[model samples]
Target: MQYRMLSDQRKRWVDCLRGFCMMAILLFHTEIYYTGTSIIGYNLYVSDALYLFFMLSGYLLYKKAGMIDIKYKLKSVLRNLLWPYFIFTSVMAVPKALAHGERVDNAWALVQNVVTGQASWFIAALIVAEIFFVVALRLCRGNLFALGSVCVLSFCCSALLALNGNLVTFWQFGNALQAMLFLFLGYVFHRYEHKLVVDVWPTV
Candidate 1:
């Protein structure tokens, strides 16, 4: 190990930041899912701030890959979702079948729902959202500027489409777009980490 500063401390920092982020996300999720109301407690603001810092994390972690193979990267990212998805399907199958008043004994139907991304779009959405910029970067040849442009365009498109909320493909899949926004933010942070931490406290 010739030299590496953050590498030694990376797990510590990543854990701290990730813990905070998870708390915020959990708060926002709980309030929304449990209440079905858009009411913002203190956690919503905290969640928003955590998301900003997450962008910084993305900037720091996602270094430019020199010769990334798009096919492999795509497959690799998707693979992370496979095992959990199967688990989700198996667990939820009986409950969903029972609720539907269908033959709850049909294991095949439950498996079909999970495998096809129908029952677990949220998990699928989060997985793909995290990979959006990675995939985009692969297509863009790892150009930071190009990646940032996609991020900005995604934000603009989101804002413009927020009013209608039906123009974009797959926009109906709950919070998938929000997840993609995080991925894009990661790209931005990865590109601009210096400005972020350097200006965090403003040296005296």
Candidate 2:
């Protein structure tokens, strides 16, 4: 009974954290849209909230990471992320194009944009990152060293891409690479949360 109460308290705190991050992101975007600059001038800090959001997502899904069926995971990703991305992108394409005074002449262009995550790039990047994380988990098979190595490699690649200004916008592969780091961090945190807390503060 005590364990159950602690679990519920943890969940409540997690939800609160998520809500705070969401509000921060919304405010950041709102300021950008209206002011053309971060009036508060804390752009980087607020932007980091998105990574935190990714971490939370990975933390929540940590239990499922142990599943052996890669195909099942991929299918879930497609159904949850890819389908919504395509449907919403398709629906909004015409209006978005018109708003920018762009001609919607090429159906292929629209299709390409959707495929490349031109509509909601976050979702697209998430799809890629989640797939990579899942595959890496399967290969690592609970080996922290292997997983850490993969995360380091991903971070380096993403940093290089950013430095070279080679980030594929809309496709957001670079963003996903960095996002993987946070996701992995979240997974590891969940896996060792109690030990970490104890190490940080011996007395709870």
Candidate 3:
């Protein structure tokens, strides 16, 4: 009963955190659009909120990691993420192409952007990251060291890509590589939550 209560409390806090991150992101974008600069001056801090979102997603999914079916999960990911991405990108493409037809070259180029995930890049990156997480978890088979190694490798690859001017954005895979590290870290945190001390503030 006590364990159940603790779990519930943690969930509530996690939801609050997610909401806070969402607001932060909205504010950051709004500020940039209106003023051409962040009020905080350091714009990256709000960008980190996106990483927190990735981590929170992984943390929540940790419980289901063991039960993941690769085929089913892949289908679900595609249906949920890819389908929406396509629909929205297609909707936006009509206007963009109409507005700048001369610069667009051809319809195939727009299709290529959708395929490469340059259309709505974050969703593409997330799709890849989630798939990578599922595969890594299956391969690691509950081995923390193996999982950590995979996360580290992903981070290194992402860093290298950035250093080399990001030669490939296919499916936004380079961004996904970086997201994998935060996702794994979130999963680790949740997996060991009972061993860690987390405090709730009533005043806030």
Candidate 4:
């Protein structure tokens, strides 16, 4: 059937995108480990995988949250994010903490790192960003102007923090702003999918 064929095509594209992202991240991290510098040629796009990642996550999660019960979604997200964070910090980071002779034990050390944005910080940040997204969506209540104003405010605050680094222990504040922007874009795209172009090469 046509539906089956379309589903298969989508799966293939998703797999291809996933593999490409994995390869790109591996190469970028490998380069960072070795040269401590640029990505040879095609530096801009190649080095910005995190941006792509954030946008895709935003888009997918927005679609999913719309489709399912938000409470269940929240529970699932917490379970998925927190368990790995705890394990990764405890198992992987505790050893490094021990080797470094830091006076903190595994649990306390993990808590400190998570709070300070030094250990599995992206998950923490993303969790906060998702909360913010939900809150904004609720408060805005389909008022695009209100949403846009809040986003503008978030961006301004983030830029201000970047300019003045005093008492800024975490970079994820700015990241949350960027995430919100991308998430908003995703939500809009979902809402307007019928109006907008959806093709291999999308317009606008």
**Best model per lDDT:** 3
- Residue 164 lDDT, candidate 3, scale 0-100: 90
Model 3 residue 95 lDDT? 69
Return model 2's CA RMSD, one decimal.
3.6
Winner on TM-score (1 vs 4): 4
- For every candidate in turn, the CA RMSD to the true structure comes to 5.4, 3.6, 3.3, 4.2
lDDT of 4 by residue, 79-131 (tens): 88666766776576766565555655457756777656567555666766676
Rank the models by TM-score, top first.
Answer: 3, 2, 4, 1
Which is the leading candidate under TM-score? 3
- Model 4, 55: alpha-carbon shift in Å? 1.2
What does candidate 2's lDDT look like per residue over 123-175, in tens digits? 78888888888888888986878987898799889999889988757578887
Instruction: For candidate 3, write residues 1-204 as lDDT tens digits.
Output: 987988788878888988998898888767866786788744466767888888987886677336568898889888987889889998887565655443565889888877779887778888889999989988988788998899899989899989999745888889899999898889888888777666633444
Looking at candidate 1, the ten consecutive residues that score lowest on lDDT are 167-176
Query: What are the models' TM-scores?
Result: 0.62, 0.81, 0.82, 0.73
lDDT of 1 by residue, 87-160 (tens): 76778788766654678666777776776666755556555555665677677777767866776676566666
Which prediction has more favorable lDDT, 2 or 3?
A: 3
TM-score of 4: 0.73
Write down the lDDT that model 4 would get: 0.63
Models ranked on lDDT: 3, 2, 4, 1
**Candidate 2 minimal-lDDT segment of 10 residues:** 195-204
Model 1 segments more than 4 A misplaced:
25-61, 64-67, 92-122, 167-181, 192-204
What's the lDDT for candidate 1?
0.60
- Flag regions of model 3 displaced more than 4 Å: 1-4, 64-67, 94-108, 198-204
